[model samples]
Target: MYALKEREMIFVFTGPHGAGRKTVAEMSGSTLGMKQVISYTTRPPKATEVDGQDYHFISPAQFVAAQADNEFIEVSTVNEHLYGIKSADIELMFQQSGSIYLILNRFGAQTLKKLYGEHVVQIFIYADRATLEERMRESGDSEELIAKYLSHYEDEMAYRDQCDHVFENVDLAHTVFDLTKTLDQNLNRNLLDLD
Candidate 1:
């Protein structure tokens, strides 16, 4: 894929868990040639998740060491699990591709926007609460975890209006198409000359 602008913008895809943020961001990166910053995690891999592809699964000690080394740009903890996007990962993406994309939670998303200023484009993936819970259930989330997720909907929407764009992930095909097209229109599109 060709690049559109000289001043590349980083894409920050964010929303609550089960909102398909990772799926959509991966699709965008694959199809648009936008590089994504791989994050490191202390959590165990899920069924379909690949080791290097999904996350750099490491130990808590390793994670803390990396944090101390200033290896990550943003970091967060959920329960006993730790997650962070390495600063080197972002720098490498910018070196390879003009733009970059990464998935994050609402807090991380806001942090990225504030850090990058105009260079960041935040897209909030939103779905109905019921749909979110159902998706989580289908993904093998425990009832307890699903309940935990469901209770956070209100807090998630507290800053929804601050995002540059918001959309539902009901239909993957439609949502991807719409989101990509909108991004091209609002961003640089000279690289993607597809008709």
Candidate 2:
């Protein structure tokens, strides 16, 4: 296993679909001086989403070629669609000063944790079933899909123990403040603090 140097920190944000991962990522990136790492997806862009900004929308053939070339740091299938984070994008971000944050799903987070180990600061965002359902409803998700998501909520919650931080995103402003404080305290401590 490769041990992490004190200077390196990789922040990972993960949660269920309606739990506000992307929103938190955007807000946190703006506040933390960290760039939001855009991921590639085979799924078509949503009506409100812009190409490259929301995701690097690509054809399945292109995705497969990238995978074959070992270009992705992590990849996974979600709701019958494929998503991946390019390895070069992460490496390039780390090449700059300050920390890098990647917003990903549980499977991708687990894969990155295995690859990066101590260099990573994994965070799991969560909310109660009612809160999640309400958020999903507001997003216009179908009841059947919301029910399916709720059915898997318990299993998802169980994975929280695997993360370095488990944040309850009940209040967006408060949660962002709390997360910023935690990152500053844990990852921005003095050099000797790692000892």
lDDT of candidate 2 over 112-133, digit per residue (tens) = 8888877788888988888999
Backbone clashes under 3 angstroms, per model = 0, 0
Best by TM-score: 1
Which stretches of model 1 miss by more than 4 angstroms?
1-6, 190-195
Q: Model 2 lDDT vs. the true structure?
A: 0.80
TM-score to native of every candidate shown: 0.90, 0.87
The models' CA-based lDDT, in order, is: 0.81, 0.80
lDDT of residue 190 for candidate 2: 27
Q: Where does candidate 2 have its weakest 10-residue lDDT segment?
A: 186-195
| Over 4 Å off, model 2 | 1-6, 189-195
Candidate 2: count of backbone clashes, pairs at least 3 residues apart or interchain: 0
